[model samples]
Target: MVEAQHKKELERQLWNIANTLRGNMSADEFRDYILGFIFYKYLSERMEQYADDLLKPDNLTYRQLTTDQQTILDDIKQESVDYLGYFLLPNELFEVLAEKGKNGEFILDDLGEVLRHIEQSTMGSASEDDFNGLFSDIDLTSNRLGKNPNERNQIISKVFEHLNEIQFLLDDTEIDVLGDAYEYLIGQFASGAGKKAGEFYTPPMVSKLLAKLVTAGKTRLRDVYDPTCGSGSLLLRVAKEVGVDNVGYFYGQEKNPSTYNLARMNMILHGVHYRSFDIQQDDTLERPAHSAKRMEAVVANPPFSANWSAAEQFKTDDRFSDYGKLAPSSKADFAFVQHMLSHLADDGTMAVVLPHGVLFRGAAEGHIRRYLLETKNWLDAVIGLPTNIFYGTSIPTCVLVFKKQRPQADNVLFIDASQHFTKASNQNYLQDDDVERIFNAYTARQNHDKYAYVASLNEIADNDYNLNIPRYVDTFEEEEQIDLNAVASQIQQLDKDMIDIDKTIADFCAELNIKAPF
Candidate 1:
């Protein structure tokens, strides 16, 4: 409980700093700035701690080093690059900048240089790919920050001062809380980013569900992957399902440069070592940074019905060649499925969230659906979700679970959970109970009236391979078995009461010397 309170306070303090200092910038815009600064603060503290540990044998602390200690600093720099993947001088640490800002000194130029130095520190190192352009989204010269340079400096300095007031206690084991705080900020920013949120963030509940589905029955994973990694939330979520050490590595690809930077920060912030994650910045479908790699678990929440090139050249591509058809260029839902499936290890499990249309949409999508059932029989389960749970779109969606070597090879589990969510003023959400219920139903794999059903392969094929949730899990309710006799009795009573009310009005009209026209 104390830990929970600390986390709550940390998130509140960080969010307040973000909002109070952002002026009129959009949520996503300020998101880039605030998160960037917070990341810098985290790195500074980590560097100091690691350096202190290295100096312990000499009975010294990092802050005790003097300018004359060049040899010591050089030794520290080489080791830091190998272990922490970056280096910072005592003069360039986040604490020094915050102290300068607090002392009413201009540090914008210094701050920019420090951020650049951080990027350059990893040059030619194994971590270069992870650190390159990590700070590109933080454009210090943008006018959106303030009317002039001095004003920009003042606002940023204040942000630093406020952030410095909070101690993340990085040395504590709850360092995970710091990572959680970062995710909290991302989720908070996503709440206001509207439809654009889908581009970089998936709702926490959905990410958890997908993670659980993919990592089911496995204590450890060889590796996990997410092609549409976004801020790398889903990939990290998968690791949390099992202990982090249990997962060997993380592989992901994303297209948005700004969000790509955020993903790398998120991975490092979450304690995922640089050597453990290979996040590439590019279109997953077109480039597929990890095309030659296969993973033991795969998860994705690709853009709903997004458009893709669907070039004829892709038909012969290894990922798509076997399908005999491509998801239409207009709706790439099935296209993403085939891409993920291509990366699934023979014994791997894959779970993806997609629009409901993928279930019943005809044409190329229909052909692909048939091939999965008739040819591969890889689809394992279909679970419906409530609409409006997503930040951007209100369309209802479904989770499709696939396994190449399924023990239950004869049937598929269908769960209709569309109505199981808590409705808020602007959005509906899944309570823990709701997520657990769906997961339980998924594991049980039995028929429950109006909720879940296990349909045979023959039954699915008889319906022309349509996997729509409603087709198998019937949730139709007979309208409360309306009692006509009771309704008629109430109407009759209302008629009598109306007559009496009319008589009373007539009497009042007569007393006022007005005509009772009735």
Candidate 2:
């Protein structure tokens, strides 16, 4: 519990640091600088540790090695690059740069060169792709840093100094102290980012539901994936549900370059090694990054009501081919659904967060919804979430669970959790009990009052395959019985009082030489 408290304090401190530098800049803009600084600090600490271990047996400190010790230093660089995937010269380490900027002179140019060298050093190595462009977002020379190089260097060095003072304690415990803090900071930024937050983050509570739903009966996951993996948080949450050593691979794609870099960093920060996860940068909908593989558990909270090309060329594309017509170009909810379903393994289960429109919208969406229920029979359950539960959007969303093969093959579970959330000042949240009840309803596959229902395929067909929540869950509240006789008596009394008031008004108006007021 002490460790947990320490972690929470660390998270709070990091968030305070984030707000300190945020100034008046946009959350997205300031996020890159702060997170980049944190990553730099992480790399620097790891490098220092590596150097300390290497020099311990040699009776010479890595920091004390002379510039003339070229052969020995070169060997150390070769080995460190192989192990850490990037190299930082003793002079180029973050603290050294910070100290230079603080006491000596402007160091923006040197720092930029050092960051470039870190990326360049990985060339011709297995980790090249991973390290390349990792620091691309940290533009030290940008006007946003400051008007002049000196001012820029001052702020950058101050940030570095502040970060250096923190006891990251990465090695103090197996749990990722710094990584958890990073996630907390991400959550903080997401809260303020509003609609833009949806681009790169899935709220932690929503992530929990998806993770739990996908790993329900499993002891170990062979693999887990999120085609639209923002920061890789949702994918990582799956491991918490089960011992994840057996999770053989992690697969995901992000459309934004910055988020792609963050996902990779997030994976490494959580002690997920470079080789175990394959995160690519590209549009997942158009490109379908992992076409060659099918994952055991897939989860995604794609952008709600996002638009897509739905290019005619994709008519032949296997993901949407079976559905006959592509989801309309305007609404891409089902397009993401179709993409995730295609990548699902035969024995795997997939849970995705989608806008409620996908439930009852007409035209192509209705057709696609019909096909899923009537043709492929892939959808297993639809769970409605409370409104304003997502980071930005206020419209209610739902989780749609699909399986290549399902334990309950004949019926689809529908849960109306929209009214079950606790209302907060800014947003509605699902409490612990709320989450458990929803999970219990799903796992038990049992019916409940005003909360859950199981609908047969025939019943769904009778409704023309409209899987809307109301048709199944019946959230309609009955009206209270009205007392007509009491209402009539009250109305008669009111009429008599009105007549008496009119007579008095006429007498007053006649005396005052004015017409009676109506």
Candidate 3:
């Protein structure tokens, strides 16, 4: 408990530092700067540690190395860039910049150059794409940081110095202390970011449920993926569920450039090496970054009811060719489904969180639903979530699981978890037990009275392949009976009390000669 309290204090301290530098900037604007500085500090500490480990035999420190040690330093630079995917010079370290900024006597022009140098070093290497444009958002010349570049540098370096003071428990993999803290900061920022929160972050609880659902009966995963990777939290969660070492590769795509950078940084900060994850910055639907690969497990919480171009040209596209109709541009929920389904391996499974509208909404969505059920038989389960489980949206959502092949080919399980979650300040969250219950029902194929049911293809067809939750798992909680006689008696007693109060008021008004108050 003491340790838990300490960790909470650490998180609070980091949050304070983040908000301290924010000042008049909006949370989103300040978030990019603060998170960028923190990433820089993380890289610096990691580089320092790497250099320290390499010099152990020589009893030399990375900070103590001389610039004239050309041969030895070059060898170290080659090794460090290959291993860490980037390297920082002794003078370019985050601590050095922060100390110089606090002294109020140094310019950070060198610091900006160092940041660019890190990206340039990755060029012509396997890591070039990963590091390219990663620091584009942290513009030292932006007036948002300050009116002048010197002031901007001072603020950034100050933020770096403050970040350096906080301990990010990198060595303690037993706890994931830093990763958890980073996620907490991301969530904190997202709360104030309103609808924009949906762009990059999944509320951790929902990520957990999706992870567990996808990894259900599997102890090892060769690879995991998210088409709309966001900050890559869902991919990392899958790694945690079935030990990180067991995952061979992490693949993801993000349409937003800022979020794409965030996903790559998040993967690195969590100790997932550059070689282990492939994140692309582009529209997943249009470009389909990982089109050639088939993942072992997949999970995603894509933007709900998001719009897409749904151009007529995509009709011949392999992903939507089978659907017989294109998902309307107004709603792309089915488009994501089709895309994810296209990427699922013959033996793999995928679980996606989407709004409830996809289940019963007609037209293009209905046509796609029928094709999936009657043609592919890939629809596995539908799990309804409690309302407001996400940050911005309040409407209830549902998780749809798909498998290229299923052991139970004749039926699809539906669990109504819309009533199961712990309510927080502004959102609902799935507790551990809530997650377990849903997973157990899904795996056990349980037939609870109204909480869960496995509907046959014939039943689904009878309902015109609607796949709506209530059509299968009836969660219509009945209203309690009211005793009309007792209600009438209470109403009569209340009427007498009101009459007495009126008379008392009239008497008081007459005594005061105030024309008898009504």
Clashes of each: 0, 0, 0
What are the lDDT scores of the predictions, listed in order?
0.93, 0.85, 0.85
Global local distance difference test of model 1: 0.93
Residues 162-253 of candidate 1: C-alpha lDDT, one tens digit per residue: 99988775566667888888999999999999988999999999999999898878899999999999999999999999977789999999
Best by TM-score: 1
Which 10-residue span in candidate 1 carries the lowest summed lDDT?
166-175
Q: Which ten residues in a row have the lowest lDDT in candidate 3?
A: 167-176
Identify the runs in model 2 with alpha carbons over 4 angstroms from their true place: 59-61, 170-175, 482-518
What would you estimate as the lDDT of candidate 2? 0.85
lDDT of 3: 0.85
Q: What's the residue-level lDDT of 333 in candidate 2?
A: 94
Q: Cα deviation in Å at residue 328, candidate 2?
A: 0.7
Clashing pairs in 1: none
Instruction: Give candidate 1 misplaced runs (Cα > 4 Å).
Output: 482-518
lDDT of 2 by residue, 1-518 (tens): 87788889888777777776766678988888888878777788777778878988888777787779988889889988888888888888888887776685777888789889988988998888778798888877777777887777777777766776776745747346777788888888788888889888888888888899999989888889998998899988887688546578889999989988888888777767666788889999898778989889999999888899999999899999999989988899999999999889999999999998999999999999998988899999999999999887899899999997887789999999999988989899988888898999999988898999999989999999988888999878899999999999999999999999899999999999987777
Sorted by TM-score (best first), the order is 1, 3, 2
How many backbone clashes can be found in candidate 2? 0
